[model samples]
Target: MNPIIELRHISKTYYLGKLDVPVLHDVSLSIMPGEFVAIMGHSGSGKSTLLNILGLLDKPSGGEYLLAGKEVSRLSDDELAGLRNKFMGFVFQQFNLLPRMTARENVILPLVYADNKTNAPDELTLLERVGLKERVNHKPNELSGGQQQRVAIARALINNPLLILADEPTGNLDTKSTAEIIGILKELNNAGITIVMVTHEPDLTEAADRTITVKDGVIVSDVSSGKQRTLAAAGSDGSMAAGFLTHNLLKLQRVRDYFQQAMRSLISNKTRSFLSILGVLIGVTSLIAMMALGQGAQEEVKKNISSLGSNLLFIHPAAGHQGGVALEAGAVTQISLQDVDAIRERVPGVARVTPYASGRGQVVYNGKNWNTRIDGTSADFPVIRDARVTEGRFFTDAEATSRAKVAVIGKTVQRELFGDRDPVGEFIKIKRIDFQVIGVLPAKGSSGWRDEDDKIIIPVNTAMYRLLGKENVDTVDVQVTDYNAMDDVSDRINKLFAVM
Candidate 1:
């Protein structure tokens, strides 16, 4: 019969800041199937390190390890973890039961990590077999030290592991609890479950079918009971080593199990869980709000830039200076209506040209009155400035040539004077002069600290000669037919104005 575990010339060395500390040296051992082996050693004897290597928990620095006729070092880390979960069961001295789970929940914990749990034994029956039937609902803290160890044994049996590795299982239990745990382990061994226990106490070795003693990282003695069963005799029906060589790959089911486990832990610790959830919510909300604010600001800047009109340029007279002292803007040279007409006729790639002038005025309609900005331009103002006339129509070229008393009201002026009523064709008095309202402009919202819709529109000739009484316009707005011809048109306009 082949040995279930084989180790030949195993060595372990740990590095501590350039210092090599040797734990095991040239250790060789083998254990057949269905054997309860006890490894005994003193403190710092390297016995625990050997047990760790045997359980596949740690790798040896030298030599080979074979478990169930397969090389251990050939498998990847994930495959090794799957193999450990499927075939090896561990019992720690501290019980290692999740403090938040009941005994039954802790017993079924290994099934959560197992890729295939179709053949897993019933956790309740395992608990009953370990004499914890009445304490299955109790938590680790609620149970006695011996009862906790019994729960750990039940957990080890949940996956029906091929080998059980106990690391000082009774190290913390009282004398009575130790006896109970040892008896339960002997019963498990007798029932054909292979168990290898590591203990420093000599009395615990009596319960094992074989005892192996180690001193100074080397085996000093190995004594076995003649009644130990081999692999063929123990698994006569061939169930003991069935599927032992197969590798279990990770599956998606484990993700759900992990989330369930996390939710259980959170439910168990309410205050800490609430605080953690609150902190995450606050951080996520702050990130979303900052992103939204930045996006909104970016969109607003684009809107304002587009509102200024596309492919358009403004021609303003430079400020005058005398004796190195700067004077007010447009004090030296003023843009007149003739200059606007010249640009429209002579400038190449000129799509539209309009003279623009602005002033403050008090507009009175019926009993309502509002002080607002007044702008005067030609009919091409809407097309050049991208201002849509939502109602009525702009003043025609003939109206501006004749200096007619016709005006277009913006949304704010309409709201203050008309109040939901149509102001089209109604006469409003601007600076006490009766002007007919011809149209209404669409809402333009706010730009900077001023409302773009809080204004009125009139013909340039009427504004300069009739309303505001100015000699020349404030600026000239020019729109180019194509973007590429802007530089040449600008040069020609500069040359024309430079000569003028």
Candidate 2:
């Protein structure tokens, strides 16, 4: 019969700063498929290190280790983790149960990282076998030392592992608890699960089928029971393919179990969880806000450059201050239609000019009322501002000169007042005055907190005289004929405005 595990000339050494500490020297061993082996040693012996290497938890400095006929050193870290989860189970002396989780949750925790759970044993049955059925919902603090160790044993059996590794599992328990743990381990061995235990107590070896004694980093004696049977004599197969199934099942159950465990922990410890979550949120929010601000600044600059049109310059009144406090823009000086016309006629390199004003008003059409922004501009506004009319023609220059009540609406305004219906040739009331919708502006998306496509445009003369009742316009837009003459044109326009 082939051995389940084999190690040839394994050596382990630890380097502490500049000194070399040799733990194990040229050790070799073999463990069969159904043997309950006990490794005994003194305080300074290397029994624990050997057990760790045998369990695949540690690597030897120089050795060839084989587990079920497969080389161990050639596996990647992820593959090793999957193999460990599927094949071997570990039990420590401290009974490492998550304090916040119940007994059942602790027993089923191994399934969270398992690669193949189709052959997983029933969790409730395992718990009941360990005499923890009634106390399955209790936490670790509510159970005694023996009961907690029983839960750990049940956890070890959850995956139906081929090998169980126990490192001083009953070291902290009393005499009675130790007896009970030993009896349970013997029962498991009789049921054909290979177990390897590292202990210093000599009486525990009587329950095991084999005992190996180590002293000062070397094995002194290896004694086995005379009644031990090989795999062939026991009528069992030791091949890996015949033993375990590799089908993956219950993948989503792993995630759900993790989420439920997290929620339970958070609900149990309210203050710590709140502080932890708040800290994470603040950190993530700050990171995202910084990234957004940087990207938004770049995007905004690009959008503004594109929207300005070729060789275009915008002129606006400078803000004023009173009592050392800043005042609203256009508070001190406002541009008028006369100023716009003067710039257009006298300014050199000027290609096009448009007067602009803006205000907010309530718009009503067919019993639906919405409040929106209103902009007043000339016919050349679309050319200088790079705005396109999608539905109909913009108001003509003659319409602006005659102060005709005509309007063009943006996409958002169109949607709010008229759903899918055409708005051209329809009349809407703005500030209790009727205006004909002559065109629809294309969508412009949003800018910061404001929707750019939620406004209406009308003629500058009509807005200043009939709708808004203002004498002066808000700003002026100028487009130059040549790109290189922009600076000179801006200087001349500033000089002309200063003297006017």
Candidate 3:
């Protein structure tokens, strides 16, 4: 009989960091067609390594391997994969079924990688052979341990390969399931399919036609059942025989095999893949939401500031000023109404001017007390501050001259004092003075920690004489008619103040 598979002087070594360890040493073996062989070995006896070498799952560090009389050791990676796929199939100790796919889908997996003109048979035939005909659509988790292994075995035979490489196929089964699997293997061997199984079970070892024991990187014994079958050798048919595919087709086949394996892995470990995608989803969502909010805020700011219609500028007297004059230490008075009049008359393009004093204090009304911001201003306060009255009305020119005690409360004051009730006729106290809430200003949320709406507006003359006793306004707000002439207006205001 001729050998169907051969390993000559095969030695495989691996590196653990900088340390080299040898697993198989000068191992040589051969298997004839239609033979049932069992490889027996203790753990770490290089049995798995040898099985890997035979299955072409791992390349040996040194050796020559031949499959069907062709030198596979000299073949490239792609060539090796093609040869393995065409003539060999594998059954793992754990069954290695994809959890997301059904039993019938698992059985068809080998055919997806095999290059053949033949189509896969109906799911019924495969399921019937494995005794899983009634459970063809069941996923791996839905089936028992034994049923899953049977599906795995059906997958191994799907491509009609000449050899089956099973690593501890019955390791995870019960006595009944073990006997069932062993019987299936026997039936396959009887049908001209050669099998190479790795196991320590004496019953499984005895069932094979031959048993080879491995120990410490070498074959310890090789016992035969005294039965052998013939194998055909390659001839000049102008095309390579079985297990011999062209290099390009081999590469394409290997690429397909790799992707298929990757897909299987991802499906089997669903939680791991889901966790990885979750991390990416969170990062992408946060990044997009923040960018959108920032862009919206930027657009709103541009719109509001531009609507003010430029030409507006503010002038502050020197520190500790009252009127418009730059104050000196211990000086009695500084900025006064004269400064407001001066800017209106002398500044180029000057339209109107308003000067004001403001601060925070406690106010009381109707036996309730609350802290409120107070603003004292002229009749031009709304125009200078860019505030609008939503109801009622702003102070009239007569109210400014008479130093009226009437007041307009902001939107926040309305909410705090009246809740949902209308505050138009309500009364609130400001620094021991009773004032009427004439109107409510439109709300402007928070601007640099200051609640712009939580305040009351009163005539500046009243705030100075009736309550605060302040002699001068510290700042002057100027509104000009010609925005394009702002620079000239500011220069003229400076020139007019230079005389004092």
Candidate 4:
């Protein structure tokens, strides 16, 4: 008889860096229609890999594979996928059901992917056929290991495939569940579905019309079992008794197959499987840490900024204009220390004022230097910005009064200059100007496009006359005396800067 499936000189090789390791060496086999065959092998004997190749889950490195008398190895990818979908079903040891989907959805997924031209079977009929009519709506996690495997079997049969390739389909089930699964396979086999299973259990081989034993990547035995006495003796029982007897026998067979495939996968790549998990572990850890920090800092900033007073007003640079009003060249220099002083003196609703000047510059320590931010502000700057001192102290009024060459460094600056040691009282030069580090501010984390904690702050006067020598402040921020007066204070400041 012509075989339903045939393998010719099939060899599968996998690459480990530059070395080629052969798993299946020149393997050739054939299976006739309506046949129940099991391939038995020890761990690393290439049983599962050959099954994968035969099932089209993987392609062989070099060889010919034929299914239903059609050459599969030379077929294009889409053509192979089409053939596999139409005629083959795979039952894996782990069940491989989608955890989030109900049993019915899991079974229906293959049909959805396989056939697009016709309406597929609904949950009720498919579930009833698989004996899962009562548990159709339950998810894989909600069911026992046996039920999940049963669902896998249902999915396999849903396609009405000619061949079933089961790779250890009952590895995690109790004996009772194993029996139920094996019973289902026997019934399908009786219905004329050709099954090619790889199992380790000797009991499973008893149900097979043909058993092929493999060791060290070579077939050791390919033999047909004479009609067993037990199968023949079943005819003496009533029809129901005979049916139940055949069902129970096949259940033990499936359990054996499940363990055989699992042992092979586990022992064959002991290091690879274990090491693969480490990558997932590190990825999960880093992902969780990043999420926690981002969420925690966002909440902290929202709380801190909210407490700083709702009346606080911030100014961001506008390339065009405010309220969609375009400005002339340098028109926005409208914001200055003059505006800061005016807001403090003219607006009764304004509480405090601070001028902020910031741009990028370089910092030098010993012979090693780093590019960093340069910001110039006064003592009231921290008060207006609502910044807290993490260490040492903020610059004093006396330091701002004399235009002192003292500065406060942020977390990153301290790390770059002093490593783990304190940076306070240490002198560092920025833009060729030597200045003592008065304090180290706490890391405030990232905000928008800026790292607020990566800056080095100096007195506004020293920045104006000595380092930056800028004519006008880039932005001016003011705190209103009361939250209700915020709008009025802002209106007053806007008018004061209108002529600039």
Clashing pairs in 4: 168-258, 199-257, 204-253
**For every model shown, what is its TM-score relative to the native structure?**
0.67, 0.56, 0.52, 0.46
Is 3 or 4 the stronger prediction by TM-score?
A: 3
In model 3, where do residues sit more than 4 Å from their true spots? 117-119, 228-244, 247-500
Error of model 2, residue 304, in angstroms = 19
In model 2, which range of ten residues has the least summed lDDT? 230-239
Per-residue C-alpha lDDT of model 1 across residues 1-500, encoded as one tens digit per residue: 66778898999999999999999999999887788999999999998999999888889999888786677855667667777888889999999999889999999998888877888989999999988889889999999999999999999988888789999999999999999999998888777778999999998998888899999999999998666454323443334334543544556798889899999999999999999999999999999999999999999998888777878878998899999999988899878888888889987889999888889999999889999999989988888888879999988999989999999999999999999998899999999999999999988899879999999999989999998989889988889988888888889999999888
Compose the digit string of candidate 2's lDDT tens values, residues 262-379: 8888999999999999999999999999999999999988886776677888899888999999998889877888999999999989999988888999999999888999999999
lDDT of 2 at 208: 87
Off by over 4 Å in 1: 1-67, 70-81, 99-101, 112-119, 122-125, 190-192, 196-355, 366-368, 378-380, 383-386, 396-405, 432-434, 460-466, 469-500
lDDT of each: 0.88, 0.86, 0.79, 0.75
Q: Which prediction has the highest TM-score against the true structure?
A: 1
Better of 2 and 3 by lDDT: 2
Task: State the displacement of the C-alpha of residue 7, model 1, in Å, after optimal TM-score superposition.
Answer: 7.0
Task: Give the per-residue lDDT digits (tens) of candidate 4, residues 1-500.
Answer: 56777789888889999998888878888877778888998888888887888888889988787665556676667666666666678898999998767898778767544433144446468678768899998988899898889889888877667789999876777888877877788877877788888998877777778999888777778999865422211112223222212222234444555566456556666898688778889999999999999999899989657534456876544455778888763465545566666667877787777777776778888776878888888787666766756777888878876889998988888888788887778888898889998787766777668776789888887787788877777766777778888777777767766654
What does the lDDT read for residue 469 in candidate 2? 88
**Tens digit of lDDT per residue, candidate 3, span 159-250?**
66778999999999999988888888888888878889999877788778899999999999999877655433422231332325662464
lDDT of 1: 0.88
